[model samples]
Target: MRRVQVRKTHKLFIGGAFPRSESGRTLVVEGANVARASRKDLRDAVRIARQAGAGWSGATAYNRGQVLYRLAEMMEARRGALAAACRGKDEVDRAIDRVVWYAGWADKLAQVIGSANAVAGPYFNFTVPEPTGVVGIVAPAEPALLGLVSRLAPPLVGGNTVVVIASDAHPIAAVELAECVATADVPPGVVNILTGLRGELAPWLAGHMDVAGLDLAGADGDAAELERLGAENVKRIVRGKADEQSPYEIAAFLELKTVWHPVGF
Candidate 1:
C-alpha cells in the first residue's frame, strides 16, 4: 500500500503559536481549508500584541535589526516552500530581500529620522521616533507574499508589534511567513497573523482602542468606514503602497517624541 500523504492544517498564528479559530471555523480556498478567524480571535491577537510590544520597543535598535535579518534567513531557507504557496519564486525573492532591506533600516532609522532642533529658550531639544504600539495591518490581495511582507516588515523594524489580517484569497504565505517569524528569534506576540474574511475581522481591529496604529492598505471598499472607526482612538492610519520600500514606511508606524534638556548657565 502506498503511504498516505497527510494534509497540513492551516491555522491562525497568534502569540507565536498556531491555533484553530476560537469559532472553529474554516474557509476553503483553492481547495485548501484555511482557518477563518473570528472577532474573539482578533481581540486575543490585539491583547497579545500590546503585551509583546513593550519589550520589543524597549530592545536596542541593533537587536531588532538582527532579529529581522534572522527572519530573512528563515525565509531564505524556506524559499521553495514559500514560492509554492503564492505567486512564484520572484515574489518570494522580493519578500526575502524586503525583509533584509528593512533589517538594515532598523539600526539607522534614528540617524535619518531624528534631529536636534534649535530652541528659543536656554534648553536643548531633540526628537526621536518611537514605536506606535500594537499596529493593525490589512494585507493587500496581490503578489501575496511580497505585498504582505512589504507591509509587515516596516512595522517590525520600527519595533511595533503587529496583528495583520492576511490576504483573504491567499493566506498560506502569511502562515508560512509566520513559521519564519517563529524560528527567527522573535518574541511571542510580536507578530500575529490571522487568515479570515477581511470584511469581518478588519472592522473589529479598526475600532479596537488598544490598536494605536492602523494600516488600511488592503481595506479597499471598507477603508472609509474603518478609518472612521480608527479615528475614535486617534489611530495613526496609513494606506501605504504594497511594494513600497522607504524609510517613510517605517516612520508611519512610529511616534515622534521630543525631549528637552535645560542648558542653564
Candidate 2:
C-alpha cells in the first residue's frame, strides 16, 4: 500500500480563525487552489478588523512592540519554510528583519512623530499620533513575502488593524505568514489575510466606509476608480512602490491628535 499525502486547504484568516470563503469559491494560482475571497469576505474582514481595532490600538505601545517582536521570532523560526514559499531566502531574511525594525518603532513612534506645542496663552499643548482604525492593504504581486511584510509592519506597529488582500500571483507566502500571525500572540482580527484577485477585492476595500485607510502598493487596474471610491469615505490612501520601507508608511495610517491643558491651573 502506498502512503497518501493530504493536501491542505488554504482559507481566509478572519477574526483569528481560518474560514472558507463566504462565496465558496477557489482559484488555482501557482499550482494551488486558494480562496477566491468575495466582497462579502472583504466586508466580513473589515467588520472583524473594526471590532479588534480598539483593543489593539488601546494596548500600551510597549505591549504592541513585544507582540511584533514575537512575530519576528516566529518568522525567524520558520525562516526556511517561508524562504522556500517565497522562492528566496534573502527576501525571507529581509522580511524578518523588517518585522524587527517595525517592532522597535512601536514604542518610539509617539516620541519621533509627536511633540509639545508652544501656545501664547496659559495652556500646555501637545500632539500625539493615534491609529487610523481599520486599514486595507493590497499586497504587491512580486516579492510577495517582503512586500507584504513591509506594507503590514508599519501600520501594525502604529496600532492599526488591517485587512490585507495578498498577491494573487504569489499568495503562498501570505498564507504561511498568516499561520505565523496566528501562533505569535497577535490578537485575533488585528490582521486578516485574504487571498484572491486584487481586481475583485480592491474596489470593495477602498470603498468601505469603516476602513480608515488604504495601502494600494500592489493595486492593479483602474487607479482612478479606486481613488474615487476611497474618496467616498475620505480614506487616507497611500500608493507606494513595492518593498519600500519607511516610518512615513506607518505615519500614513496614523492621525495626529492634539491636546490642550491649562498651564497655570
Candidate 3:
C-alpha cells in the first residue's frame, strides 16, 4: 500500500505548551503551516513570562546552570531534527555549544560580574546581579538555529525568562529549538517562542511594561522605533549585534543590586 504523508502543524510555544496563534493566522514556510503570532499572542507570551520569571529568577544559580546544561543535552539529542530544520549541522552544533557555554556561566555570573564595595563606612556593602525579569528577543534571520540560540541562551543564563519573536524568513529552526526547550525540563513559561513577522510582533514586545529587556538583533526595519518604545519603559535594549557566549551578555539581561549590612553587629 502507498503511504500518505501527514503534514505537520507548527504553532506558538507559549507557557510551555504549543498553541495556535489567537489571531488564527498561518504562514506557509518550508511546506508547513507555521503560526503567525499577533500582538495578542505577544501579550499573552509576555504575561506568561512575567508570571514564570519570579520562580525562574529566584532559583539558585547552580540549579539554573544545571537546567541549562540539560537543555544542551536535549538539544544534542535532537540534533538531527534541528539540523534538518536549519538545513545545516554546523549551525546546530554551534547552537548546542552556545547553550552549554552559557550554562557554564549561569552559576559563575555573580563572581564574575558582582563586586564587593570599598566604602569608608562602618558597614559591609556588596553588589550582586539579579535577573531583569522578562526579556524579549528578535532573533536574526540568517543562521537560523544558531542565531536564535545565541540570543536566547544569555537571558536563560542570567535567570531571566524570555519571549522571543523568531526570524520571519526562517522559523522552522526556532520551532524545532522550542522542542528542545520543552523537553529540557524548563519551568512553564520560562521560555516562550513565537513565530511571526518581526514587524508585527516586535513593537508590542518592546513596548510591554513588564518586559525588562529587548534584544533587536533581527528587528530589521524600524528597530529605532522599537528602541524608542523600549526607552519608554526603561527597557535595556540591545540593537546592534548577535549574542556572544560571554557573562557580559548575561549581565546585559540582569540588574545589579546593592545592599549594605551593619558591620558592628
Candidate 4:
C-alpha cells in the first residue's frame, strides 16, 4: 500500500476567491511557503473597500458598534487559533486583550472622545469625533498580533471602513483576525484585509485617490515614502508616537468636527 500526502492550502482571501496572488508570487514564512499578493490584488482590495465603505459609513453608529463588538467576541472565541497563528502566548494574549479593550470602546467612543465646547464669542458649540471613511493601515511587523489589533480597533470603532495590509513576515495571525471580522457581523468591505508585503503594498494604498485617511503605525523608519504618497490625496496620516500604550491613538484615527449654534435670545 502506498502512503498519501495532503497538500497545504496557501491562497489570498479576496471576494471569497481564496486564490493565489494574481501576480503569481510566493514568499517563505516559517519554513512554509505563502502567496505574495500582487499590486493588482492590492488594488482589488481597495476597490472592494471603496464600494462597501459608503454604506458602512452610513450605517447607524449603534449598528457599527454592534458589529465591532461582535468581532471582538469572535476574536475571544477563536483565541486558540489566533494563538497558534501568531506562534506565542504573549502575542495571542495581547491580541485578545486588544480586541476586548476595543470592544468596550465601540459604544463608549462618542462619550470618551467627544465634548462640549464653550465659545467665548457668544455661540454654543460642541465637538465630536467622526469617522474619516476608508482607512489604509500598514500593520506593524513586530509584536504582530498586538500591533495589528491596535491598528484596526480605533478606526473601526469610529464607524470607518478599513483596508489593512498584514505584516509580511508574520501574516497568519492577521489573516485569522480577518475571520473574526467576517464573523463579527462587520460588513464585507468595512474591514477588508490584504495579506502581503507591506513594503510593497503600502505605498500604493497611501497614494490611492479613494482612500480618505491613512494609518502608518505598522510601518517603519518614519514611513517617509508612505507620507509622501498619502500627501497626493491629502489623506490624513496618523503619526506613530514614541509611547506605544498611549490613548492618543484613539483620537488620531478620528476627526474633530465642531458644531456651532447661536445662544438664542
Candidate 5:
C-alpha cells in the first residue's frame, strides 16, 4: 500500500493563529489553493493590528531587537523549508540576512535618527522616534521570500505592527514565512499576513483609516488609485523596490516626536 500525501491548506495569519478567509473562498495559484482574502478579512487584520500596536510600540527597543534577532534564528533554522517555498536557496539566505541586518538596527535607529535640539533659552528640546502604529504592506510578486522579508523587517524592527498582503503569484513562501513569524516569539497580531490577489485586497488596506502607513512596493495595479485612497487618511505611503534595504525604510514607518522641557539652573 502506498501512503497518500496530505496537502496543506494555506490560510490567513491573524492574531497569531491561522484562520480561513471570512468569505470562505479560495483561489488556485501555482497549482495550489490559497485562501481568497476579502474586504472583511482586511478589516479583521486592521482591527487586530490596531489592538496589538500599543504593546508592541511600548516594548523597550532592546526587547524589540531581541525579538527580531530571534526571528532571524527561526528563519535560519527553517532555511531548507524557506528555500523550497521560495524556489531557491540564495533568496532564502538573503532573506535571513536581511532579517539579521534589520535586527541590529532595531535598537540603534533611535540614536542614528533622533537628536537633541540645542535651544538658546532655558529650555531643553529633543526629538525621539516612535512607531507610527499599524502599517499595511503589499509584498512584491517576485522573489517571494526576499521581497516579503525586506518589506516586513523594517517596520517590525521599528516597533510597528503590520497587516501584510502577500505576493499573489508566489504566496506559498509568504505562508511558510508566517509560520516562522509565529514561532519567532513575536506577539499575537504583531505581524499578520493575508494571501490573495493584490487587486482584491490592496484597496481596502490603502483606504483603511486605522492603518497609519502603507507599503506598495509589490503593487501591480493602478498606483494612482491606491495613493489617492491612501490619501483619505493621509497614510504614509512607501513605494520602491521590494528588496531595497536602508535605514530610511524603517524611518518611513516611524514618527519623530519632539519634546520640550524647562532647564533649571
Candidate 6:
C-alpha cells in the first residue's frame, strides 16, 4: 500500500480570522485533519453575522446582485477544486450551476415572486420579497458541495446573512466554498460558516434570541426539535423536505409591505 502526500490542517472561521478551534480539538475525515468547532465558535459566527447587519440588508439590490453574480463567476472558475473537494463530478457541476442559478435570481426574484394588487378603498397595494436577516443554516451531510451551496444561496440572494454549521463529518467542501465566497466580492460576515456537530450547535442557533430566521434542512433527526425551539422567537423556520432539492425559493423568506396614496386630485 502507498500513501499520498498532503498538508494536514483544519481551522475555524470566526470573525474573519482563520484560527484553530478554541477547544483545541480535531477530528479525522477521509485521511484528513479537520477542526472540531466549539460552542464559542458557533456564537462567534452569529456575532459576526449580526455585526455585518443592515449594511448587508441595506445594500442596494443592484450591489447585492453584482456580488451574487460575482460569486457565480468564481464558482465557475474554481469548479474543479470545489467538485474535487466534495468528491463528485455531478455534485460539483450541480453546486456551480446552483450558484449561477441563484445569482441570476437576485434581481429577478422580486419580480417573479412578487405581486401587485388593487386595494378595496382606492388604495394601491404591492408585495415584494425581502431577506429575513441573520439566518442560521444547517448544511446537509450528503452530496456535500451542492447540498451546502443549496442551503446557503437562497437566503443570501435575499440579502440575509447566514451563520452556517457545515456537516461535521464532511466539512472540507464547505471550507473550500468559503474561500470562493471570500473572493466573490461577497462582503465579509455575509456568510459565516462553521464546521461542527449539529447536535452540539444546532440548539444554540435554534434558540439564539438574536437570529431572525432558522433553516433546519440539514438538522436531519433534529429538524422538528429545532423548529420547536425556534418558536420562542417566532423565527422563520424552513424544514428541509428530503424529497425536495436544496436552496428553496419561497415567499416566506420575504416581508411584504403595502403603500397607499392619493392618485387623483
What is the TM-score (0 to 1) of candidate 3?
0.96
What's the lDDT of the predicted structure labeled candidate 6? Answer: 0.78
- Which model is ahead, 4 or 5, in terms of TM-score? 5
Report residue 179 deviation for candidate 1 (angstroms): 0.9
Query: Comparing 5 and 6 by lDDT, which wins?
Result: 5
Query: Who wins the lDDT comparison?
Result: 1
lDDT, each prediction: 0.94, 0.91, 0.89, 0.76, 0.92, 0.78
Estimate, for each residue in 1-265, the C-alpha lDDT of model 6 and write its tens digit: 7898676366666655677778888778755677878888888888889888678878877788788878878877887777768767777877777777776667777677777877777666777777777899888887788778877887888888889888877788888788788888888888888876779989989998878888787877788888889999999998653224433453446665555665655
lDDT by residue (78-163, candidate 4, tens digit) is 88878877757777777666666665665666687889986688788998888787888888776667778888887777777788
lDDT of 1 by residue, 1-265 (tens): 9999887899999999999999999999867899999999999999999999889999999999999999999999999889988888999999999999999999899899998999899889999999999999999888789999999999999999999999998898888889899999999999999999999999999999999999987878899999999999999999978899999999998888999999977
Off by over 4 Å in 6: 1-8, 241-250
Q: How would the candidate models be sorted by lDDT, starting from the highest?
A: 1, 5, 2, 3, 6, 4
lDDT at 110, model 1? 88
Clashes of each: 0, 0, 0, 1, 0, 0
Better of 1 and 6 by lDDT: 1
Q: Write the per-residue lDDT of candidate 5 for residues 1-265, one digit (tens) a residue.
A: 9999987889999999999999999999878899999999999999999999989999999899999999989999998888988868999999999998999998898899999999889899999999999999999888889999999999999999999999889999999899999999999999999999889999999999999999998875567799999999899998857778999999999999999999896
Question: Could you estimate the TM-score for every candidate?
Answer: 0.98, 0.97, 0.96, 0.86, 0.97, 0.90
Model 4: residue 56 alpha-carbon error in angstroms: 2.7
TM match of model 5 to true structure? 0.97
Residue 9, model 1: lDDT of 90
Write candidate 3's Cα lDDT for 1-265 as tens digits: 9899885689999999999999999998877889999999999999999999889998998899999999999999988889998858888888898898888898888898999999998989999999988999999887888888888998888999999999988999999989899999899999999998888888899899999999998976678899999998899998635645666778888899999998994
Candidate 5 local Cα displacement, residue 198, angstroms: 1.2
